[model samples]
Target: MPWQHKIAYLIGKPVGISLSNGQGTSGILCDVSNGKLLVLEYLYQSQFALKQYDFHMIQDINGFPPCMSQRLY
Candidate 1:
């Protein structure tokens, strides 16, 4: 699939991500689009050096929206 399409699918779902370059740290998909992602509570070992992963999709989790809503003041 094209990169854009792949991003589209991840927009509203929880996904597992593994950074390809940096310490191979894995993060949960907090937000995603055709070009970027927001990982939440992410942590990796102390050896990886890359900043971003190569985009790997693990099994999708149930419950909770991929993106959370914020209250306006």
Candidate 2:
């Protein structure tokens, strides 16, 4: 499977998203796709809401897009 799809499997896991723009958003990895990510109860730029973000637009999946690392995203 592709790494993008691997991110989809992270549903229900907590993850911190770091964007290429130097912004970060943290929330439960509710859903993922080749094009986007759905986050629930997310905290970004001091804002709170449920929003879907583009995958390519993100710099990193804070805890690791797959959460396989010792330090979870």
List per-candidate RMSD values in Å: 9.4, 6.5
Give the lDDT of residue 52 in candidate 2. 85
On lDDT, the leading prediction is 2
How many backbone clashes can be found in candidate 1? 6
- Across residues 34-64, which tens digit of lDDT does each residue of candidate 2 receive? 5789888645587767788987777767444
Weakest lDDT window of 10 consecutive positions for candidate 1 = 50-59
lDDT of 2 at 71: 68
Residue 63 Cα positional deviation in candidate 1, in Å, after optimal superposition: 14
* lDDT comparing candidate 1 with the true structure: 0.43
Angstrom error at residue 35, model 2: 1.0
Compared with the true structure, what per-residue lDDT tens digits does model 1 show for residues 24-60? 2333445654445555543456543323222454222
Number of backbone-clashing residue pairs for each candidate, in the order shown: 6, 3
The positional error of residue 33 in candidate 1, measured at the CA in angstroms, is 6.6
